[model samples]
Target: MAHLFKVDRVRLLCSCGVLKPITAIYFCRHCLKLRCGNCVSHEVDTLFCPNCLENMPSTEARLKKNRCANCFDCPSCCHTLSTRATSIQAPSPEDSNKTVARKVYYLACTSCRWTSRDVGLKDQTVATGGWSEQDNEHYKYLQSLLEHYRSVAQQEKLDRERKRFSHRKSAYLSLTDKYSLPSLLGRKSLTPLSPYAPKGDSSQSLDMTASEATAEVEGLPDEIFTEEVVLSSVTDMEQRMASPEWQPEKTSDLYPLHKHILVKRSLRCRHCEHNLSKPEYNPSSIKFKIQLGAFYHVPEVRMIRQVELKSEVETCVQVSLCNPTPHDMTLAFLPFVPEAYTAMQQKVEEPTDGGSLNTSSMVRVVDIPPEKTDLTPSADVALPQGQVILAARDDTAEYDDQDSISSYKDDPLVVAWRRANKVGINLLVTPKANVSRAKVGFVLRYDYTNTVATASESRTVTLNIPVMVDVGTVSE
Candidate 1:
């Protein structure tokens, strides 16, 4: 039986030759093909903090190393840290005889009950961002190494540009005619010298020393073997690894970590380079600007009940089909042919100039081939003959009491029942001799109404989609 948790029972074949459920795939209007997560391109559209809902620009995010400046996470539990304030009595600076109460803020994790005060971190005078950052002992050495590499890279780039410029013909050839050879030589001497040319004393120097490997190592302290260990005061591997710059072994060294930023991305079809899903620009909004999920554009198939299957025995299995579109649909079942789908993919037309220019104009370094999946069915399915008509979707049909089944004449053996924009049909399945789990597949040919009409094309088109259904295990 089809349940919300059992969506994998019925799967649809994606254009990349992978089998996926209808809810996990997308329908591209320009390419007229089914695309899955593996066959689509993802692009980050926005960067924002999930806690404060504050958006940051790309340059600012890169400068901050993709971390939220105003928010923090608990180092022990990795949860969002909340700011808590407390009041304490202190001697007044102007009047030593009087005592005054002042409020201070500290970070706390409600989940793990971890607070900044556990590690002896000083309370912040203000709530936003006054906490001190951890300093690395090798910071100066790392900066020197980075500067040395940057200078080397710059020198190589200059050499490459100088070589390229030397190969090109000089544009000042005509100027030599107006001036004598001596004057032309004098003009060349006034030009600046190439930076790549060697200069003995005037050359810039980088301050960096090469590192050498050594066999000398520091031994563990004698307290490790002489003193007893307390597990509660030690930090786990996960907590220590959270701060890689300074992996804290003891719970007293742990500090609050900066909250990482999250990104909102949009999906695009790889073949035609069209946007399949796009979210709104607002940071707090959950709605989408353009979403083309298969659930909204394709007919949904659901199994009615589980059935037992024996070898050479025809068992009736009921399945319901629901049309999600506003226009009426005419659908028919056809025999599934693996070879036909392969040939059809080869004949798929290339994208033409109809919309905006595609962004994938750069040459690719590696070209990936489409994946191929095995689709052999283990059971035989006796598809009902003729076509089935599903009415357009109506919002008020659920309130109506009158039966909508009497309007259409249907075969009682094939059509089990009829409802608004949905109909149930019976299928006959025969399992193979040694098959434990029965599986059947078929091609669904339906007339689709294209809402994106062009000047030279019609609004209706025919589409064929292959579907595979996993029936229950065969009965002995």
Candidate 2:
């Protein structure tokens, strides 16, 4: 049981030639292929704070620099800062002789026992916001620089568009040629207009003050090695670097940091351009609108127990196959051929019926090829000859003591045990003479019932998935 949690004894080969667990791979229903993280497209859906769970729009998030306004983090420990209320004595306005107790709120970190008062921050009357933020001295200059760069990029984009349209005639010229009108009439009718052309001269004259290099650099303040230092008052590297704009040297200078906003991302299949996983829009909901994890669509293979092996000797290994889908599955073990698998994957890359989005013209600029994996088996596996039928997943099967009836007959030598939707099988493995560990690879051919099938497509389709198992080390 411990080994099952720690080791990936059984791994499925993804279409990108990388071996991953079934949990990490995704099945694209439209393409009928496996997609790994490296081969999928990620899109940010929403930005929200983890502490307050307040959703923020993309524009607002950008304006706020992707941080929550009300929520704050401790500068010392990088933990969520909680508001602590304390009672303080205040003079009553109605009566000058008496005093009243007023509750004041201050930000405190429970993890590091740091408080806003430690940094000379005044306590606020209200619990929520009102935390003073440090102003950046170079903010105006930075904004000017950003605007200059944006205009430059816009100008370059217009130049490229102009170059692309250089071969084609203008709208005025086209109209004149089509109507056989005089050139004077064409010029008087309308000027040649371009959609990509800049509307004003502001973009053309965009500029910023250039920074000049100085010969002298600012030096650190001198203490003359006379003042004693307290280690507790000094800030560590992590605390000082948390706020890049103002790197505080001492704990007294540390200020409450705005909590960084987190984003919920949706994954799409790179080949088919269909969503593989999409979470709900609400920040509080943990449910996903669409999830196509391989664990739900493909058969999962788990090693029942660790098996002992000897070099160049045959050993038996037991493994369990669980059908995760609601439909019954017919599974068979086939000898894995790396060449055949690669060829089959190439054929699977042909575009299939996808969503309404046209992905044919869409080009990927940042598509990174997955690293090549060694599919050669270190050991030989003698697979079972016949097919094994697995029952549909029943949620209540675990509570029932009586076993369900099976229609299809299973070979006793191949199948060791069967319960619910899981079936245990045994296979013979022979490690190489010089190998220290035994590794066996095979192809699991299963009939998958596609739930998202159209009228023209078949509901049941046969898919062959390459599986590799680590059969443990060979005994000396």
Predicted model with the maximum TM-score:
2
C-alpha local distance difference test of each model = 0.77, 0.80
Residues 362-387 of candidate 2 have per-residue lDDT tens digits of 22224455555667788999999988
Question: Residue 275 lDDT in model 2?
Answer: 92
Clashes of each: 0, 0
lDDT over C-alpha atoms for residue 111 of model 2: 99
lDDT of 1 by residue, 46-118 (tens): 8999999999976677668789999999999999999999988878989999999988999999999999999
Segments in model 1 whose C-alpha atoms lie over 4 Å from true places:
1-4, 138-228, 309-313, 340-372
Q: Give model 2's TM-score versus the native structure.
A: 0.82
* Clashes (candidate 1): 0
For model 2, the stretches where C-alpha displacement exceeds 4 angstroms are 94-98, 155-229, 340-365, 404-408
